[model samples]
Target: MLRRSRCRWVFVCILLTVLLRLAPLKSDSDPTTQLIGDVDNTQSFGVNPISLILVQKLGYQSACNSCSHRDLGFTGRVAGKWYSVWADTLWAAPGVTDPELDTPGFHGMVRSSVSLLTDDPLRVVDLNLNDDWPVPHQQPFIPFNEDWGESSRTAFGGASLCEVDAGSATAAVFILVNAFEPDLVGAGVAKVQVINGTPTVTQRFGPKGYWWDATTTPHYGDKISYRDERSDYIYIWGGPPNRYTGWLEGGYIYLVRVKAADVFDLCKYEYWWGHQQGWKPEVLTTFTTETAALWGTGQGQIVWNDYYDCYILVHLGIAGVTLYMRTAKSLEGPWTPDLEIYSTTPIDGGLVYAGVAHPYLDPSGKSLVVSFTNNNRIEVVKVWFK
Candidate 1:
């Protein structure tokens, strides 16, 4: 039953990808699936009307000639300005799928798109546009944790895509990363390496490499509230995206568990409450710092304060909050706010969206405390560090 289920999901994905690349499906009766990103865009700016039809569609020419056609993004001009889709372009519902289907719609010149596929066990679409600017196509996207060997193909083989999750390595180790989707590489994937490992660099999960399969789903040791003084991994912790039901309807923080000694190629970021496919995973706590931070700082950031050596969550805006004090000795902490942190410029920052946190030892030695500023609002929470 397990094998049969896996095959069904896998085949469905293949069908979706095939139907997407093959333009103009035969009929609207079959109800083919579409794989478009949330945003659509044309390079030209200030145009009267943006055109999605002009975007180049690669008709799986490779599946017949060389290798199979995989990960694709669009780059074209409309008026004159320059804009681009992400490294992976979004798939639109086939014309037959829905001529009226306009979602994943165009967003003027900043046209972006997302490719939606269901995780066999229903995995989350871990996307990191936490920042406004999209990552460059030339930049290396290394995958920190994914199911490499579960598929019939050898490890790192039979890949449809790959990406590097470089969260912890960047803030933690300061390793300068540089990689690219190999040239002439079919079913393309890139080779990632740490410039320095005296201490492991930022650990991250990206959707650029390795196809997802069963068996490699469950992972142990993921941290829920990220706070580490000397840990070497940084993870994008959260359950699947657009969860329409259950506790995760509003989204929740996922525990990205990785050993200080684990390589970027082997780290794992799992749902904090564990996987509950087709059903919404429970959010251990209602404190969704970033997404729920509706104060309007965008996605937000999770940072480890090198100065304080504790976690600082700067989420909302430039002058929001800072980690000041924790009221209790436990995670059920009624943390006290340091109102002065509002408007304090972040010493160093990024989209601290639950990726990294600075951990501190509580006086009790029984609890762990970490602090961060959401935008400018300072927050300090006690968590279990050991």
Candidate 2:
């Protein structure tokens, strides 16, 4: 009896331990909880750290000016290029497709990329939404290489797109990325690969892993970070891995810095010298849920309006985001918040997403020429603000 009792106690203890280990890790943040989900989840406007204007001039030309109204949204730095994600009216979503914001799956969730402008027609890789990385209108040199897939549940195919700043030579492409991959089922371990000749480098995470279906939180905006100060690294947030990934509806922001030294300066005769250069990225902090907004039932478009003067987050998910502004002078707390003037509801369209032109100043600076996706057409938002 005594031996049996001891054995039973040990068994119970072990079972309890396993249960505790498997217990779900809840996210403390609201937005983080919703945005950075298992499968998950832009640009621009205004200023740089140096305090110069972000958008200096604005221009528009419909790449599909002649096509049968195809959907395209892919922006690259090679000078005026974009590719939409949609194939046609059949590809429109409940939000953009059903514009009245009358879609049944009313949750404000954008699981893919939306291009603002395409230098040419829209191109799409024939891959699953949650399983492939698309190389916008352009074709990959290596036909065997798959674009890219959503690694962790937090990311929604790890959407990525490029944007040409309004006034600066500095261009960027926000991508759904993971610096590290966790060992779990369903969560895919990601590997970032740059095009063979795009003057860029790629990084690979740990062995491929899968996501845990149990985590269904919403994942939002990719985290763009600068590790070396030359260029920035972009990370797509999602759920998985007991450690690095946060289990909640949240936003993951990673910083990848690109420096002049890291680039291959053929003009100046600089090269990698046969060295492998990968994206060096790190996580900032995760935004909580209550603080962030959502797009469901009634509202949509929870976006961050970042500028050089400050990072203005518009919580359109709730009503409008609490504008938080930070400047190069200081990036700490107690920044200015635009308690007013940030519109909550869309006037003409439903949820609005900025396209390839991440809000730069126009030559006029009196207005903001922003390209956004509505239902069918890639429309531009002309902000007549100072």
lDDT value for model 1: 0.25
**TM-score between model 1 and native:** 0.27
Off by over 4 Å in 1: 1-191, 194-227, 232-235, 245-248, 264-271, 274-298, 306-309, 317-386
> What TM-score does candidate 2 get on C-alpha atoms?
0.38
- Overall lDDT per candidate, in order of appearance: 0.25, 0.28
Worst 10 residues of 2 by lDDT: 266-275
Total clashes for model 1: 66
Q: For residues 1-386, could you state the per-residue lDDT of candidate 1 as single tens digits?
A: 99999999999999988756544334423322111112211011221111111211111111111111122211111122111112222222222122123245532111122222211111112222222232211111222332531221111211111112344322211111112222111121133232332111133233433212111221111112222324543333322222212332223222333343332443332223222221123323322221121112212233343333343332332223332221212122212232122222443462222111222123333332323322212233433322
lDDT of 2 by residue, 1-386 (tens): 99999999999999987754444336544233333322211112234332213322222224321211222232333233322332222222322322333333422222333333322222222222221122112212111113344422233222223332323322333232332344222322222222322312133222232222213312222321111112232222232222334323222222122232322211221111001222222221333221222111111111123333333322122122211122222211122322222222343555433332223334333333434344334444334443
